[model samples]
Target chain A: MTELYQKQRAMRAMRKAAMQRGVIAVLDVGTTKISCLILRFDGVNLNDEGEGVGSISGHSGFSVIGSATTASRGVGFGEVLSMRESERAIRTALQSAQKLANIRVDHVIACFSGGKPRSYGLAGETTVQNQVVAEQDIARVLSACDVPDYGDGREVLHAQPVNFALDDRSGLADPRGQLGERISTDVHMLTVDEKVIRDLAHCVKRCDLELAGVASSSYASAVSSLVEDEQELGAACIDIGGGSTGVSVFLKKHMIYCDSVRLGGEHITRDVSMGLQVPIASAERIKTINGGLLATGMDDRDMIEVLGETGDWEHDRRLVSRTELIGIMRPRVEEILEEVRSHLDAAGFEHLPSQQIVLTGGSSLIPGLDGLASRILGQQVRLGRPLRIHRLPQAYSGPTCSSIVGLSLFAAHPQDEWWDFEMQSDGYPTRSLKRAVRWFKENW
Target chain B: MSQINPDRYTRSDPAPSLWSYRLLRLMLSPYLRRMVFYGIPALFLVGVGVINITNEQRREQVLTTYSEMKTFVTERPEFTVNLMSLKGASDSVMQDIREVVPIDFPISKFDLDLDQMRQIILGLGPVKDVDVRVRSSGVLQVDVVERLPAFLWRRDDGLEVLDATGIYVRTVTSRLQYSNLPLIAGEGADTQVAQAKQIFVAAKPLKERLRGLVFIGERRWDVVLDKGQRLMLPEEDPVLALERVIAMDQAEDLLTRSVKAVDFRLQNRPTLQLRSGAMEAFREIKLMQLGQIK
Candidate 1:
């Protein structure tokens, strides 16, 4: 069927709306923080090949007009822990962000951290009704795929036909009029717990905002941060948040797979808290200020002051070496990376051309995190910062803000997805959402 | 000194039936007549085909082979030389590549030699055509054509060159030649090369003056600076970029001279860059490009 069409149109409409309205908002709902950003869309910057839009005012079309973040409550492991508190957090972040942008938003595409995300490279084939594989025929073959019922209480987050094979030609992006007896499709589908998605959707609803769409935080982070080459060949994005670490894999510029580890910066904080006998907040401060994976001979002599709960302990806390902190924290950080590596392996990440890795999130700021990650993840690793857009606030431009900035860019221009689709059902079918989107406009 | 004799026209009279007459003429032209009149090679070809391939089954066999040849490209896999990696030229990057590719190659199975594959796939992400050869001294040699970069991706790590295929063939240590290359930024860049390639390949008209491209959301692309001026284009199609480029040149004097940058990530309008103030100075000099900003 023509499923790819609706997705394409929805994405086109969202992008068009952002361009026309000139302002867009991105909302990131994580287990630790609810961040919001308002961006002003600029011009249609055209490249020589006439792909991708250009900048606004001769600058990148996106700029952070306003930003606001609230401490996330009633959240654990990246999913809503309690509906009421999550709603309050959502309202608080949005209200402040709207005040800064000086506008109101009726719809919000929320990015969450929960869900046991799984990926499948499904394929389908059909002998073309005639020798030529028309779009309809492609759709038919895609629909013909015996896509298993992903089970109950689950939603298909992303269903995309990544590659197409027409007759003897493999890897064909579009095979509409190609003469072929058999056409095959490689579709990547990602699904998550229905209850988690439903809760997030309900939370948005409770906030009186329409759920335009939903994306995995790691997936969105990967979109805003990864470079073209990294994405094409293959790359993994590790988003270490307060309560969870999100992992997303990209190949062919699409998030072929996504998953989240129920551990993140929170674990580090806990390790510091239990080790040093400090409050959660104080542990966070120390972790950020004196964090390192490698502590050498020089560290033992480096003393740090640990403030305590006894209101009058001023200097009573003994100084601890940086090496001591690393000794405590390394195991946790290493655990997270190992978990991510397993996730990537399960996604078949090794098959891609390039195996570069990007590390993002607020907690990735530890001094030697990139080095540690590269050593552990078995790839070229670098800490990721959000791509520069117009009017981005200097305060929010670091790796700490990759998710919110990414979410904003995502809202203004949502990706091609399944809901934005139209099933041709002309006894014809397509698996890719973009084609399904396009199929709707022209056929549906 | 060479002359044609009138005796060459000796076969003008008829044979018997149309088939027998034609057969006799064919037979006589080379063997019976042309042997005494014209040549032998042409006669041999016609006799072989007429005698051997005239049957329906034989004719079908020949047609089938031709059709098969059209599809499979059955020439020996042509030892395609990729030339993407080099042995010692920038060993760090070369070493980095080893992390992603298998250290011990399956050369035997692919009918490729390690030395040959090393030369073929090395330094070749952007290269279009490449050839591998053995030197007289037994050194493996390679000839390559690298992919032309349409944009300069300025990332958190460093600047790298990406071709239409979005392969980061080499890092751009020098921006002197391509100071205004389009840029592709963001995370997961290696995975999005296909998207970048689509955009790069689509930016054909602006190729001569293209500086670099920037990738924002891994889903779409943004045109960074072009001709030193800024132009904004949409993610859908750079038709707006094309129109703005045309409009600026036709009306606003866009790219008429030097440009600052262009924004085309929007829907309708394009922001023309004019170096009028500190803000632009702030915008133009990225921290990564600070070293080269003389």
Candidate 2:
């Protein structure tokens, strides 16, 4: 745990250095595509009046100077499968983005949606020694949290203090300088397979980029797609990607739980290829053109020509009714949504005040997905596109590029994680020095 | 009867090779790009020039070419000084000036050292001041101001004409050469030529008898009249003393007497030395009156 804390602290320091350089690249290494967006931080906060996470929803502090996307290779379920091929793919996307921005970017904040994340809600309590809650008391209470044994071979991705409670009062956002006998904190810790992080880091390093920070694609998409009120009132962002459908639940503007199912649009594309006897590329084209969740009587007459490159003319020219294509695609999408519903139910998402579900990512672009997701998830389901950022191109404004856009926002305004705070001093020498300083400060 | 096409399954590579991507990134770096685009080319040109001019012979050749180009611009018809035009000088003085300057015509104006030439020409005796410049149409204009001769000083070596400020204009063999000029002779007489001229002016009535005014003792003047007679005047107001002598000559015919010299070195006292014959005659007449030798 200390080793991971030190490593995360090093990455946070690198992120600060990248922010000082004013140019950082956000990379979304998805299963279907690798998108890179270079953000140039102008250091001008538009709405910096009130302190706790000022409105980065407007994305005013940074601007997207360059954006490029390439088809992903050697990446499955948002995890790098082959270092060489994924390195090449990352190089392609970053090189094009650097060429467009006419500047070289060294630091990258990357996101992936694989690794099977598990969320643990950790609660810790400590008696206030000084009767007034201080930063050290907060740190002490946070350190008092009993970390669960999230099993071996898994690394904590995000450990954030979601809420603070003072004595009998719970849900206190900040308990500093308040009268309380006891202070406690509720921390949300998400862990993932350590091998996935190492592979992604190695891939980015192979592309000659420093991995400044890494985030889960589900959390990143939730940051961009979910509205502020929904995030405050408990909403779930379902990022239906190519190889995975990422589901993240946000409450009080913080993500409490996030998980991803290993089923996405690529599975539906494979299903279409097998059911209709067509190539994967043609099936992908056909799925995008004629894919719908709710089939109508008119969809039966809407025939889509599925093209093939076979030498036989008859085999190249094949037509499939839209109803038949929908028939091939809807079940897999429903399965992905149903998997997301089970994960939300396990997370106790039904107990939240607002069960608003936002469906986003590349696979969410299919027509009638929201209507079907509403039936399965809740009635408050809506198709979500990424929030508009400055200088984002028209082609990347669709629901397909939500994770990349959200990664840009995450790079601009990262949430405070556990490593961001000062650790509680367990050594006696520093504790005595701190006590002396506190005594001197109080007396003089 | 469908045959699968193998090419449909394969995808072309879109990534650049590692070295090429690194090279592109290095080229995109602003510092390296500026160095390759501007710095290296400029440094190369300067280095080539330095190497080409490193040899002594090549350096001399370059200097000669630069001078030749400079001369080509300056030696145009509008810039060439072909002739010299002299003003305010007599023919002899102008000839002397021409010989002293010694400038070859049809030369570039840039090659003309006018200040040195002017200093050389000023060394001539008659030239008091000179102005030399190149005017339009390539004419070198020399304006000479010659000194005017005022007095003739009879030095021991020869007679030389002096300007009014006692500067020697030229020398002559005979006094008749500048007869219209007054003659002053003494060791330091030339420094007081103005006082000598004033004394000569007061003796204008005795011009027929006045030979010249000699500066005696360099402080007083001695007006020399005909028949070897002289009038000694005071140093402070020698002209006024000479005027008193002229008044005495007009009122009492004192100059016509047999006196050899009149001394007015003292202001209130006038003394005269008579000739020897007049002295002997006056003494015998005094003896007859006393009847000592009758």
Candidate 3:
């Protein structure tokens, strides 16, 4: 645990250094595509204290200088399957983006939607040594949380303090300098397979980039796709990616739970290919053009030609009705949404005040996905596009680029994680001189 | 279906090779890009130049070419001096100046050293100051201020004309050539030309009788008259002494009384040394007055 804390701290420090450099690249290594967006931080904070949504949703601090996307290779379920191929794919996207920006980016904040994330909610309480709560008291309360055994070969990706409670009163956002006898906090910790992180880091390192920070694509997409009120009132963002569908639950502007399903739009494409006896590429094209969750009578007449390069003229000229194509795609998409529904239910998402579900990512572009999602997830289901950022091209303004856009926002403004705070001195191996001085000051 | 088939055939691998990716990144780096696009070429050109110039023959060739180019610009007709115009000097003094400042016509002004040439011209006796410049009309104008000969000093070698400040101007062959100029003779007399001229002014009443003033011991002046009589004046106020001598001579006709010389070297005393005949006549007058040798 301490090793992971040190590693996360190092990454946080690197992120701060990248922010200091004023140029950072946000790479979303998705199953279907690798998208890179180079953000140039102008060091301007548009949203000051209490300035609500100051400029472009508080994104005036950075501008998207360059953006590029390339078809992913050797990546499945948002995990790097082949190191060499993924490295090359990353290189391709980053090189093109750097070419567009006319600058070199060294630090990258990457996100992936694989690794089978598990969320844990921890509660800890401690008696405040002073009448008013201090930063140390908060740290002590946070350190008092009992970390659960997330099992071997899994690493804690994010551990964020979600709520602070003072004595009988609860849900205090901050308890510092408040009259409280006892301070307690609720922390949300998400863990993923360690091998996935190592592989992604290796790929990024192979591309000559420093991995400044790594985030789950589900959390990143939630950051961009969920509206401010939706995040505050509690909402769930379902990112239907190529190889995975990422589900993240946000409440009070914080992500409490996130998980990803192995099934995604790529499964639908594969289903289409097998059902129509066509090539994977043609099936992808057919699914994009004709794919719908709710089939109509008119869809039965609309035929999509499935092309093949098998050197047989008859085989290359095959046609499939849109309804038939939808018949092939809808079940896989439904399976993915059903898998997300189970994860949301397990997270107790139905208990939240607002069960608003936002459907985003590349697969969310299918027509009639929201109508079908509203039936399965909840009535508040809606298709979400990423928030508008400065200098983003029109082509990247679709639901497909949500994770990458969200990763840019994550790079600009990262949430405070467990490693961001000073660890309680009791967790230290050696006696602290500061603790000794504090003891003398309090007692003397 | 047709569109998908074409894309399958034309779908090139978009991933760059590892080496190509690294090279592209290196090229995108601002420092390395500037080095490749601007620095390397500049350094290459400078290195080639340095290598070429390192050879002795090439170095000599380059130097010669540079100097030839320089002369090509300097030798233009507008910059060339075709003639020298002498001004504010007499013919003889101008001839002396031309002799001292030897230069060939049609030479470039850049090749001429005016200051050195001015110094050489100033070495001539009559030139007090000189200004040398090359005019725009291809003329080297030399303006000379010649010293005026104020007195003729008769030295052991010959008589030389001296200016008012006692600087030698020229040599004179005969005294009559500058008869209006007073003659001064003796060692170091040229240094006292100013005082001698002042004494001459003081002795203006006896100008017809005065022959010249001689610098006796480099300290005092002796006024010589045509009758072989001399007035030895004191050094401190020689002009005043001479003035007093002239006043006495005017009142008593003392200079025509057969006196050989008047001595006024001391301010409190005046003396006269008479000629032999004048002394014998003075004694016979005394004997007639005393009835001793009638």
Best by TM-score: 2
Which residue runs does candidate 2 get wrong by more than 4 Å?
A44-60, A430-444, B1-9, B52-54, B63-294
lDDT of 3 by residue, A1-444 (tens): 679879998987787777777889999999999999999999645345223322211233799999899998989998989988888898899989998998889999999999999899999999998889877898899889999988999999889888999999998776678898988999999999999999999999998999999999999999999999999999999999999999999999889999999999899999988998877887888888878979999998998877777767788787778898888888887888889999988999999999999999989989999888888888998999999988999988898999989988888877767876666766454557678888999999
Docking class of 2: acceptable
How many Å off is the CA of A297 in candidate 3? 2.3
Task: Compose the digit string of candidate 2's lDDT tens values, residues B1-294.
Answer: 356667766789899788888888899888999999999999999997897689888889889999899878997887888999999999989989888878788888989999998999889989999999999878999999999999999889999989998888989999998999988888898889888878878889999998887888778888888899999888989988989988999999999988888999998998887876989887888998999879
Two-way lDDT contest, 2 vs 3, winner? 2
Q: Give me the overall lDDT of model 2.
A: 0.89
| 1 versus 3: better TM-score goes to | 3
| Model 2 chain A worst lDDT window (10 residues) | A49-58
The candidate maximizing DockQ is 3
Instruction: State the lDDT at A331 in candidate 2.
Output: 88
lDDT of 3 by residue, B163-195 (tens): 999999999889988887888889999888889
DockQ of each: 0.00, 0.30, 0.32
Weakest ten-residue segment in model 2 chain B by summed lDDT: B1-10
What TM-score number comes out for model 2? Answer: 0.67
Q: Compared with the true structure, what per-residue lDDT tens digits does model 2 show for residues A104-205? A: 888999999999999999999999989998778887988899999999999999998899999999988767788999998999999999999999999888
The runs of at least 3 residues in candidate 3 whose Cα sits more than 4 Å from the true structure, single-residue gaps closed, are: A44-60, A427-444, B1-10, B45-60, B63-294
After the best TM-score superposition of candidate 3, give how far the Cα of residue B261 lies from its true spot, in angstroms. Answer: 62
Cα error, residue B11 of model 1, in Å, equals 99
Candidate 1 lDDT, tens digit per residue, A1-444? 234346435644554554465655567888777887777766644232112222111223566777888778788888887987787777777666766765655556678778877666688888888887664676677776777768877767777677779777887755666788888887877778878888887877765556655677888888778888887878888888878888888887767778888899988989998897776777888899988888889989887777655444543365778888989899999999999888888877788788888999888988888888988887589989888766877877887778777777666555444333234464235457767798899985
Which segments of model 1 are wrong by more than 4 Å? A1-22, A42-62, A311-316, A419-421, A426-444, B1-294
